[model samples]
Target: MGTWIIDAIATRHDRSGFSCGQPSLDEFLQTRVSQYQRRNLGQTFVAVPQGEDANNHRVIGYYTLAASAVAFQNLPLVRSRRLPKHPVPVVLLARLAVDRAHQRKGLGEGLLLDALQRTQAIATELGIYAVEVDAIDDSVAAFYTRYGFAPLLDQPRHLFLPIETIDRAIDAAS
Candidate 1:
């Protein structure tokens, strides 16, 4: 939380020291982020460390978002009842990771809120049924649940929160 800004990944930032305690996540951020960006497969945002200190300017955390869908049949039985009998539209929070050095300082939560806020703004004209994510593990799943996401009836590790419901909550909070 020291002078830092969460923004799109840029060429000038260093990503060599980001280790979120998860090897896969760390590897992805270090190696594959640029390829994904180049292919238009996903849009990744970085939590860029800022301030007067030159050494602190690095990508400490990041998350990727992409257009995706969930098959109607894959939804929880109780939750799918009102949806169309087809693939439900969604925005996938494909990956989320915060550097281990930066953990417990609210960076993960901040990145998530940023992603959701961006999604909320885009939902204005897009037909997003919900925001979805395939949880990396149970711990990650629990973290998202705390933000109002619920597991898919069929896939316990998968979760989502309806756009309408999120909007309502945001309106209420404001």
Candidate 2:
């Protein structure tokens, strides 16, 4: 229930104790995340208890982002109509998970908003058209739908939120 700070994953953050009720996700955080960052495959960020030092920072939640693309044909008709036929660039929300102990504390939503904000910033320098995610289950898909993500016409589990939509939301908030 303490305050949390989100930042890029650091080598010293204690990731070994993280368990999000998903073994694959746990393993990724504990083992593969640094490799992903080192290879430029993805950028992973972690949420840790506020005030923790370099040696004591314990990851409470984490998410990863990667540059990607989606075929125009895969987009929903409404979103695709005005776009070109070629693949559209995107930022993939490759993975998102919260530790079991911290599951109901709103960290997940905070992590999502953080990811969306980061995507919006990246779009200014890159040609990212949207933020995309492949939901691991129906419940997960519903979680995203509550936040304005729309499913791809050809793949219901594949959801996307257009950068333009995020831009408008950010502007309105401002």
Best by TM-score: 2
lDDT of each: 0.86, 0.92
Model 1 lDDT on a 0 to 1 scale? 0.86
Measured over all alpha carbons after superposition, the RMSD of each candidate to the real structure, in angstroms, is 2.0, 1.4
Give one digit per residue, the lDDT tens place, for model 2 in 13-127. 9998999998989999998988999999999999998988868899999999999999999988888888989999999999999999999899999999999999999998989
Candidate 1 versus truth, CA RMSD in Å, comes to 2.0
Could you tell me the TM-score of candidate 1? 0.91
Compared with the true structure, what per-residue lDDT tens digits does model 1 show for residues 1-174?
A: 345688887676688988898899989888999999999999999888667355546888899999999889888877788777999999999999988888889889889888888889989978898999999899999999999999886688899988877788778878
Report model 2's TM-score to 2 decimal places. 0.96
Local lDDT at 170 for model 1 = 74
